[model samples]
Target: MGIYKPKTYMVMISNVEPSTIHEAMTIPSWNQAVNDELQALIQNHTWDLVPVPTNRSLVGCKWLFKIKKNSDGCVARNKVRLVAQGFFQAARLDYHATFSPVVKANTVHQILTLVVSRKWKLQQVDVNNAFLNGDLA
Candidate 1:
């Protein structure tokens, strides 16, 4: 018999998520995702362009990049979100109150249990830019 030879395997990794806008703009997928986010914000009238007030502090914003994946570990899409740096604002100086509308896990479980016991039909709705739907003032 001939000398036995072992097979070699190589793994390649790619599609790294960019950490900055400059880096992201260079990639086509990330660039498109950024454009999509801007378009959505504009179409929804999320904010108005206004001159900065001399007395009020201006809040800075940043672009966050994320790669959404499918259940099978395949990349679904490039997601970009523009978020304000709220930490820069002082509590009493910047605004009056802060509130987060979050549902408790126990409440969700109870609702699901009730629905299951009653054999009720359940429909799920996914709202894109749900945060933008809220009124700012």
Candidate 2:
């Protein structure tokens, strides 16, 4: 008889995320994720659920989910965000200004250049999300 080998089973994982609200609701852990998102929004004073104005147009909102993990390839946290669908926004009409916190490559280079010129140590740090810290009023 030939040498016997043990059977091995492997679990497959995909980067694909949920696309619909119903799909998210079906998962037990997703409920906690949704609740955590709402809590953060409320605590951050993100918005108020008031009656829609008769003469005002409001954009639609939806929940987006992401699974974040550390370097060890383990589940770190569930991130859920409420995103506004503003594709219909008109320039200089619906809104005058849009804000984004994306960092520019030039800006990063300049900052690093300054630190190197000054012979200062560079330490990575995380800052509060600008969207959350800004005054929406």
Candidate 3:
């Protein structure tokens, strides 16, 4: 009888996400993601260059990195976001009230149920930078 040998297979995994901007900069994909986000923000006129106010405290911001995946569990793209450190802000001194608009899952389910029951055609729309379109007083 002849001895049988089992073959070894090698797999490559490359889904490691960087937790800091310094580490992200080293990777080309992450660097491009950061650039893309900056370009989008600039194109949308998200912010303008302004002199720092002497009386008010400036809010600190940080870069956030995320790996977006497709439904088939494949890496779709690298996503980056710049977000303010709201936890550092004083409650009464910095702002009067804080509100975030978000739809509940139950509400979405109810809406979809109604649409299905009424036999109505449904359409979906995705508005990029929709929150940035809000007017800041």
Residue-level lDDT of model 2, residues 1-137, one tens digit each, is: 99999995543323446777778766656766777677766786766678976755777778887877668986655566677777756776665333433345565576778889999998763322223544322
Q: What TM-score against the true fold does each predicted structure earn?
A: 0.66, 0.57, 0.63
Note the clash tally of each candidate: 0, 0, 0
Where does candidate 3 have its weakest 10-residue lDDT segment? 128-137
List the global CA lDDT of all models.
Answer: 0.72, 0.63, 0.69
The pairs that clash in candidate 2 are: none
Alpha-carbon shift of residue 97 in model 2 (angstroms): 8.8
Model 3 lDDT vs. the true structure?
0.69
Query: Candidate 2: which stretches are off by over 4 Å?
Result: 1-16, 97-137
Candidate 3 lDDT by residue in tens digits, 41-137: 7987767788877766777778987777768997767778877677876877866333333345555576678889999988852333323444322
lDDT minimum window of 10 residues, candidate 2: 127-136
| Model 1 worst lDDT run, 10 consecutive residues | 96-105
What is the model-wide C-alpha lDDT for candidate 2?
0.63
On TM-score, the leading prediction is 1
Candidate 1: tens digits of C-alpha lDDT, residues 1-137? 99999995543322688999999988877888889889888897777788887778787889998887768997767778887777877878875433333344555576778889999988852344534444322
RMSD of each: 10.0, 9.4, 9.8
